[model samples]
Target: MSKKNPKTLTVERAPDQTSEQATAEVAVNPAMNAAFVVDTYQSNILGDDVDTDALVATLRASMDKSAAGDLSGLESMLIGQATALQTIFVSLAKRAHHQQYQRHLEAFLGLALKAQAQSRATIQAVIDLKFPRQATFVKQANIAHGPQQVNNGHANGGDTVRALENQTEQIEVLEGATHGGKEMDTRATAEAARGNPAVEALATGHRPKKRGR
Candidate 1:
């Protein structure tokens, strides 16, 4: 007998299963079918995208069908819609939270700015009060110790000097008070920017640190 060629003896085995046969054998469950239907409906509603009224009507119909016990398919459909709605609601909640935080931050900054403005006004008022008093004192001093009075060494010259000295001392005290007020204002602004408890106290014209101790 002639020896058979090894290459000729090789035969290609047929695939265990064709793609069409595999697909035919696979079964789609009711839940999967319901999910697909829900997805398709949502896609169509989104594509329309013109009015929320249509979406609402569709949702109401689904809900009504779910409420009626006549259809068993409604259960899976309701579950799929509920899951999608949950995701949407969660996203809305996150956006709302972010917006709320932004509003709060803006309100806080507004309050801080208001407090700083009030503090600055108070400091300005203090300076205004001091400058006018100093100007008056200087005018009185110059009038009391005019050239004639200096040349003659007027009897009241001692009293005039003492009065001017007292006035100077008063002006210095007012300056120190204004400086302290300014320092307090700066501290309050910094604390307010940091969202500290000191902000409330500062806004209310009270010192939080002193109260805390």
Candidate 2:
């Protein structure tokens, strides 16, 4: 029997082909193609002329929006977690009741209590997420350190006019009283002088001599 030498098959590659290109060319399956596709996309994104800051900002914005969406849906997730914790608590409670030893019973009960507390906390978290507490912004009031005089505007000078009128009326009344007293004194002197000369002389500021009775 003659032993035949096995022929080694040589593969031809392009002069410009890289190791990655060779690997991509050899890959036939979609999974292998997917990896290379991702690599090609990343390479395209990280090109020399690419605006790195803009790219990073865009990626950050996308991620931030996704995170915000997750937060928006967090209420349902927290409620589910609370429900699951309640189920665990119930299971633990049943196990605690069936335990024969005091230590096992205490251990299971403690675990059940912990689960119950966690469930309560999850529920509260959901409530807090859904109905967030309102922020109270207190406005700064500029208060004077000492006494401040506040002037509410005057009422159209009505008070000033009333005060002036009151002063005028007081002056007129004083003048009238003086004149009326002078007139009364003059009338009294005229009537007394008509009846007696001596009384008239005394009223006129002259000295009167005593006359024979």
Candidate 3:
């Protein structure tokens, strides 16, 4: 039987070859993807005027590093970091806080995010989590919620709950244990509450208006 050494599995690049050239060739330039990010990111995330050169450089460097890596994990790590740096630049650019200070903030954010892929991933995750959902969007779109959780998840209960959440106009729940008599809610409630045609003038949010010029 032969014993395998773990070190043998690790891949190392040749020291003589240039990393930047290899990276540029292997990885799609990050700046190309950044354009998509700029378009897709929150409307409030970026200012009209941005330091294009700096952002481009950061993206290029990130992609270059990513393409140069021998492993896919390294690629993801680089992409993640690039995205994070873009976010920072975009956010700072949105602010336009000072005379010449705008450039400094953008630079700082770019540098800070570029240095740490893990940090960028964390921040990006938080931002993703915080993004607002449309009222109709199901809360279960978040994968972190759990597999059993449905996107359009509803509260668990019987017919009574189904009525309330769905606005069924009529639903009933038994009040007592075991022998509890079924309560009739569909009785004289409507006429008593509205008084026939006396209160027909009130308008609900969606009620259509009668025509009268």
Candidate 3, residue 93: lDDT = 45
lDDT of 1 by residue, 20-88 (tens): 564543334333344435555766565533233333345556656657844434445444554554455
Clashes of 2: 0
What are the TM-scores, per candidate, against the unseen true structure? 0.18, 0.37, 0.19
Q: Summarize candidate 2's per-residue lDDT along 1-213 as a digit string, tens digits.
A: 873322211234689998777766646534334444544477656554433334444444545755776564456668899999999999999999999999999999999999999999999998888788999976444332234222335455676456556766777766664554653343443445556665554544455677989
Using alpha carbons, what is the TM-score of model 2? 0.37
CA lDDT of every candidate: 0.49, 0.65, 0.51
Clashes of each: 0, 0, 0
Candidate 1 residue 16 C-alpha distance from true site, Å: 59
lDDT ranking from best candidate downward: 2, 3, 1
TM-score ranking of the models: 2, 3, 1
Per residue, candidate 3 scores C-alpha lDDT tens digits across 1-213 of 785442221222467758775555334544745743654463466653444444555666766765785344444655676666666655554544443675786775555545455456656655554553557744544332222222335445464354445442322233322324654555444543455666565558757878898
Please report how far candidate 1 places residue 94 from its true position, in Å: 1.6
Error of 1 at 106 (Å): 15
Error at 203, model 3, angstroms? 99
List ranges where model 3 is wrong by over 4 Å.
1-30, 39-43, 70-213
Give, for candidate 1, the lowest lDDT window spanning 10 residues.
5-14
Largest lDDT belongs to which candidate?
Answer: 2
Which pairs clash in model 2?
none
**CA shift of 155, model 3, Å:** 63
